[model samples]
Target: MRLALPTAVLVTALTACSAAPPAAVTPVQATPSSTPSVTASAMPRASAGAGEGLPAKLRFTQIAQFDKPVAFAVRKGDDAVYIAEQGGRLHAVKGARTTMIVDLSAEVSKGNEQGLLGVAFHPSGKWLYLDWTDAEGTTHVTEWAFDGTTAKQRRDVLTQDQPYANHNGGQLAFGPDGYLYIGLGDGGGGGDPQGNGQKLTTWLGKILRIDPRGEPYVVPEDNPFKDTRGARPEIWAYGLRNPWRFSFDKETGDLWIGDVGQDSWEEVDHEPRGRGGRNYGWNAFEGDRPFDQGVEAEAAVEPVITYQLGEGGSCSVIAGYVYRGTKIPGLRGHFLYGDFCAGWIRAAPVDDPARTVEVGKVEQLSSFGQGNDSELYALSLQGPVYRVDAP
Candidate 1:
């Protein structure tokens, strides 16, 4: 569920809607954004802070290994770590004691990027929210009350129809403003076939925000497009292709996204706290390049860092948190990231963009999780989650 599409990739996913689907492609047409302009921002190098990105070499000690683990969640003030497997189960790990909080295999779809993709605590850690694709390939967000003994009170929060099986960018996290943010792919087909990224009326290809505690869901009062005509009230940001992983800086509250490219590049986008409604050109512009010569919107934001890879070098970018942990004296304030194909870990300053420093590596790096105290861990696709440690 996390990758690129060839320029000529064929469609092979199930299309199950009664009426015409959003991304249904027969005769592809172009929908121009509100403003048609293009700007390719160059990566700028900045000076590093004192003792920042200074660890000569880092170590990744194996903490535990799980069955194809994909997502991770840690409760505030708790030592236990929750690991979600693509096989549909949540494992709670505290020291040597491991227990199953819930099993969702009966509910989630398997293979080709479908499974338990994300989990978030209700700020207070009293409620657990899970985002997964059901067996039929539709995205579902559910909630459960947690008290450490049993995960109770199952509640279905939201659902979205997926036209294709791939490109489900399922990453769930609560924003600094307290709204639940859900990242969804553009209904799956290659090259924004559905036009969901720019079409505000649909939930696909966009970032959605809702209050899960409400009857169905509550859109925040100041959500950017809440009152715009022909727009879905829950849409916060639009025009992203497979935002595989994203995180909010623990200290700055800014949003950082690792948007997998169409075929040539990978990017990391940043948004200042409270800044929503921004368009991140997808098919129109792919990571600082005019993908199809389509004019991009003037307001369309550019990525903070954009890098191209050779045929088999490194492609998909997996974004991680800015190290605000105290344990690693040198990594503080540096944003860490990796590639699914290339397991090497790298970091760059939040205030600075271009210059990057190599950190460490973990094979099949899928996602990174932060402990309650801000310590970081890398989840690998090939078993073995690693704890980021130095000295």
Candidate 2:
């Protein structure tokens, strides 16, 4: 869904409560389009202690593993988890069983930060979308039909040329408006060598929203540049460096973006849904500070929150969702995010003035997944998917 304007910020001070125990796991049908049937009440909040602010009593159990899993999405009514591996394979996990759903090794361009990079499922669960780099080093977004057992009817919907292999931001998701949003990085090489971030003619360095349900994927009529001259009508937001990942809050529809920085800072941008046409200062500014004097004053946008590279014990921030899951009441309304390099997990309650609190920590956290129930899952780069539960 598109976001409205930023609203008033809300702050609350939370104290420690006991960790509520976990409930028994009830088996549910493993279908491709149905939501998972796991129902557990929120765990009691545990005391907030030292060491990165995660509750001292929190722990995680490995439920499943994936090989080089880069992105994942869950069906709205299905217990199954769909994972995208960097090696060009899509895998499905359901009730203790995992299987390959699609293989694209021949079409994938695998390397340093390249390959199958993102995946999303249609709200209807009948369609799945994938973003990846092709053998020619360009990025392509494709859609596939999914039956209960396998993926068929592959169709390439969007393709963009790439200058380098590294910064091909291949993340895809369907917004609340039912449009597929694709994130692309500045044409690779260090320092925006191709100058794509500041250029509006190319699809690179921008967030694009398209109606993939149509042939050739039509651009939404209201896209910011639909009537502008020499601009890609599909562009939603521009001037992004490498927006590795982005997500919309299920409740508020706010877009949380994690854009990788050049040499100094990594940023997290919060764009209220529906607020397009804003330039997320990239080559002009890095994380609210001027990076290039010439472009800094050119009406550039700013990130709602940002962190320096080494501060707060984090490296690359993995943008995540605000908790709406019933499994953890205290975690409700909290935005749970992690550091890909530091393997640290932290939660900041949305709009909470206490913006620096760390709610929990997961070891070797590579990515976060959302289930059909809206519960969050933490995936370790090595393997194992842990349901983000309370203590």
Candidate 3:
């Protein structure tokens, strides 16, 4: 729910304690990223050598549906795919049957961009994590003991007080190094009035890395700002407005982010494996243009791709994964992403991100999930979860 609106509309909605709802979306133009190129031999079989052309046809197959599914996760050695509903219930989908495995209806905050927004499992599959907004609108990243059949013994690993309801970046994932990574938005309000994006003292507008199994949590020494004075030691990257969704390449371990833009642009940022300490300029720069000339950012990383807002109704970028599954050979090496309002899913080759082709669409697209097999699934806020596959 990263939809933008006029100041008058925003104030009215906020006064009612509501977030900006979805609006019509349109097509947008993509700008190529500045990352290095990969050799043709490294590309998947069906795809023409690096940056050459589009891949074969692909389609979405309805695997199952749920009540406003926002995140999908899997447990190691388990055959079921777990979907986290915004209303605070975890559903386990095995073949055609769906079962409620964990319920937190009484615990979650209800509204746009809130609720059980993210779900992930420990690499060992012994722990389940939920990134959710509590009844008071504070974000609580909780850990639960799990035995595949049920989840119990919940404990809070991290908590942050949200300033505004909108722009709560609620996505979680385990990096290739096994550290839990969390995304949080700039304390909401248009134009970053709080100045959190470029501030190091707060966790807002940043990505954090920590070991959650510790008492509460442990900030890894390797984190970029761990020893920096006046900075939150957990921060791995900074200067983001609202990084709603991000993912790591399963094969290359490279990081990709879809940072929802402020007003004019939507962007996708890329960081090579282990390349921390990046400043994805926000409040200071939107897309490639300067937004706030007063704020200074040190060596900001430019977006690999950017699209204009309000063009063909395009709004709210949903960052996805680089396909590495055996089922979609043609999609291998291509990064998949979409817009929440536009509902169109497109894939751009890792080499040339500007040359994108529409792959599929999911109504009310909320997030994308990668399975244990490296396959992908797209979740819709409208209740359908589709598996990416060759038609």
Candidate 4:
């Protein structure tokens, strides 16, 4: 029951120029033309840390594989894992068995970085939510009821006209507050072309929180912009480029946002559970450094962790959750993350602000998921989903 807008109408709506002026912001650092070199020694290996008490020998095994699996969610009490495919399908995984739960290929727009992107389940386990790019290339957030075995009864809850396909942010999760939060990329093209990242009038380039129990979802009265003029009332935070993945610390409810960078840096921003309405630096700044000098006057939030694309032998940061699963007691409280191209998995205790030690490595880590038992699992773009257990 997702709503479909004609492609022509979407194009016209996105192209309609807005009269609002661009906010002053700093410019991002220039990207180098050549690819940076990575030494063989820089590559990571499986290594256990004293903090998480991981076993001496650790390895990963494939549980399932798909054409282009992008995101996954685990039901609270059920053993099945819900996997989202970029080609517009939701696959359910129970133990080693897999089955198709829903298909929306006709409504989905599959192109460069645009398709079925994210999925999540309500805490009550009664509903599943999906985020995707529609045929016209706009982002849509929809919810469907889960009747134990299959997904039934769909509802198109929210849709945002996208200017371009490349930077459509696609991560969705229900926070501890029982509110669903959706991430949207800055209207795409090169370098945030439309200047939507800092624009309050639009929901593009924001982390939006809404109560889905209402018709088409309702904006929470406590939203940051509840009293602001000309601002999208549902926005929880603004000024993000393309937040590819974000997660709530299962225990703390704090939010961890991984924003993809243009050329110089990849960043991870932390928002404590109750805080909202913050502005992350995008066009005016990349990471902690200033990009555009003009936007410095506007309040900007800094990332808790950042690394240069080339310096750390990494590119395209994939943000992950802190391990709170029971399988690896030693890894509990460790923040696990990896790079799309580097093919390395590393975990540093969340308590360690400096991230001094490495927990271990996983080859070609694509996405991370936590099970109903609180155990951690790692999905490989070209490999299997492995249970992150003690060696």
Instruction: Quantify all predictions' global Cα lDDT against the true fold.
Output: 0.75, 0.69, 0.79, 0.71
RMSD of 1: 10.6
The estimated TM-scores of all candidates read 0.87, 0.83, 0.87, 0.84
* Sequence-dependent TM-score of model 4: 0.84
Q: C-alpha displacement of 51 in model 4, angstroms?
A: 5.6
Find the number of clashing residue pairs for candidate 4: 12
C-alpha root-mean-square deviation, candidate 3 = 7.3
lDDT of 2 by residue, 199-247 (tens): 8898888999888888878888999999999998999988888887888
C-alpha RMSD (angstroms) for model 4: 11.2
- Candidate 3 per-residue C-alpha lDDT over 269-388 given as tens digits, one digit per residue, 9 for 90 to 100: 888999999999988998878999999988988887787875546667889999899886778899998877667777888766765767666656788999889999887776667787
Worst 10 residues of 4 by lDDT: 1-10
Each candidate: RMSD: 10.6, 10.9, 7.3, 11.2
Query: Worst 10-residue stretch by lDDT in candidate 3?
Result: 35-44
Q: Write the per-residue lDDT of candidate 4 for residues 1-391, one digit (tens) a residue.
A: 1011111222332234222211111222211122233221111222444244644334454566665566889777787888886678888877646778889878899565778989999889999899998989988888899976878889989998987767788999888898999999887776676778889899888999999878878889999997899898999988898887888888999888888777777777878897998988887887767766666426787776676765545666677887777767767787776666555555655654335244445544557787777777676554345666665
Clashes of 3: 7
Q: Which stretches in model 2 have alpha-carbon errors above 4 Å?
A: 1-58
Candidate 4 runs further than 4 Å off: 1-58
In candidate 1, the residue pairs with backbone N, CA or C atoms under 3 Å apart (3 or more residues apart, or in different chains) clash, namely 1-113, 23-194, 37-296
lDDT of 3 at 353: 70
